[model samples]
Target: MTLATAAHAPEGGTTAPAVRIRDLTVVYKTPAGELPAVSEIDMDLPAGTITGLVGESGSGKSTLALSLLNAVQPPGRISSGTVEIDGLGDVVPLQGDKLRRVRGGQIGYVFQAAQNSLNPLKTVGKQLLDLGRSHDVDDLRALVSEAKELLGRMGLDGARVLDSYQHELSGGMRQRVGIMLALVLNAHVVVLDEPTTALDMITQANILEIIRNIHAERGLTTLVITHDIGVVAEVADQLAVMYGGRIVERGPVRSVLGEPRHPYTQGLIRAIPRLTGDIDQARALPGRPPTLGTIPERGCVFRDRCELRMSVCDTVEPVLERHADQLVACHAVAGQEPDGGAPTDDGQEQT
Candidate 1:
């Protein structure tokens, strides 16, 4: 299908964001100095909508996702910003049990690599029960039954899968189990970080289907952090493009994918391979993505690689500004395009 048509399109009417992050900056303390992995980000994941955070590796996508649940490990901390979940209030200051409660309950997490995240030695039922236990769900039988029901919903044979170990299932089944656990924990918002990684194309499609199905049935607010634009196009209602520790572009999935405004976003879309016409024409982006240690401290972070860079971009950092349907941070995009020069599919100025 097309990116414009999501099976579970976010319903209009909800004005409040399920998760609102304002000026979020995450810093990792290194021997070299403080490294900002996420810098001054302002974003909103609307209630009951699937918002995709897409970028190349080291673009702070995972860092932003972890920050949502306050799970950023030591050495990396939320240096500043407010993380407000719709019903939970501000999480920046929450600590101890309060913070623990928010995690896995209010906000569920599906880490990358299901094989690595699951305990290989533990039975599926045992693991699910342990997760439930953490959320004050102590009744073992009840937890197992609930887990089975959730697994069934995810297309697994509830009883058969529950009794088995992680190694017993195929890669696709394990991945779905990872998703099922997140839903079973009863989280209002689920953060899935690269859930489709290490899977074949068919398996990837299956996983995406599972995600859309679960979201539709549960009405859970979802944040899918991925590097694949194609995957985000298939599953997300809205798309946010992150680069060099900041959100460079964000809008409705169709709008951003159809007419990307940011130069980095343009590069990414240009790089996606088309199956039919001109399949070999896909171009690779030049240069590597900047890491926390390598990114410069001032001005525009993407200036080094942007082809549309202007002299003003060298000295002044471009704040994210509204342009049509999306928010973009780039001097080239912020300036007015001459009349009749519309944006192309890859966000280039079309004469």
Candidate 2:
């Protein structure tokens, strides 16, 4: 289905959002001081749909996703914010057994690297059974049946896959099995971190198809975190654009991709290579993303590289405000477009 069509909210037309996050902030405590990874973000993940969170490295996309699982480790901590799951109360403050119960049971997570998640020395069956045992499924036959069933959903031979070790399977197969593991606990929400990274084009397509099918058939809410715009274009119903530890733009995938309001969002869309368009016309966003420690204390984070920047951008930070259909955080886009001529050959507008 098309993005616009798939993104139309309402499975039964009465279900509340699956997840709600408000004023969320994650900080990493360092010797120098505190550095914010995710800063005061507000977002809603609708039930039974895929939401794509897109940004470059260090943009806090993965950190934000992990926070949902209370998986942020070490120096990284959820300093502030409330993450409310549908039936469960605020998950932000959950600790020990409560937190452990929620993770891998209520909300499943597929990490970026499948091999790293698996034990090299153990057979996949042992690991799968271990997870089952944690959740109190002691029957070996039942656990094996469940493992085979989940693998079958992904079109894999469950028995064969269970007998093999991590090194025995291909990268794509391992990734699919990772996803299956997340579902083994019958979690309501699934979070996939760069699920398609490091896969061949054909493999990527197959994985995406599996994700889409699971979402449709199981009615599970999904959050896909990735830097690939192409993956979002193919799988996401809603899209959120992040920059410098904040969500700069958010709306339906069709609306955001087709008529992006924020300049950063626009640049990301333009950077995608189109088969029918002029190859050389594609341009990368100038300037590197800001480091977490180096993020400016005030003003718009993207002001330095933004072609539409005005004097106001130097002094005033932009809050996410409603534009036409999407919410965008940009002082320049909040009012008038900074008067400059159309884009030039060099990818910058003429003053």
Question: Which numbered prediction scores highest in lDDT against the true structure?
Answer: 2
- State residue 249's C-alpha deviation in candidate 1, in Å: 0.4
lDDT of candidate 2 over 1-351, digit per residue (tens): 122323465465224338878889999988768899899988878787789999999999999999998888878999999898888878998999889888898899997754377989999999998888887776868768887998988889999999999999998889988998998877878999999998999999999999998877777888999999999989998899999999999878888999998999999988888899698788999998998878888888999889999988888888776555566788877676444222232221111
TM accuracy, model 1: 0.90
Q: In order, what lDDT does every prediction score?
A: 0.82, 0.84
Measured on C-alpha atoms, candidate 1 has an lDDT of 0.82
lDDT (Cα, 0-100) at 13 in candidate 1: 18
Please list all clashing residue pairs in model 2, or write none if there are none.
none
After TM-score superposition, the amount by which residue 106's alpha carbon in candidate 2 deviates from its true location, in angstroms, is 0.6
TM-score, each model?
A: 0.90, 0.91
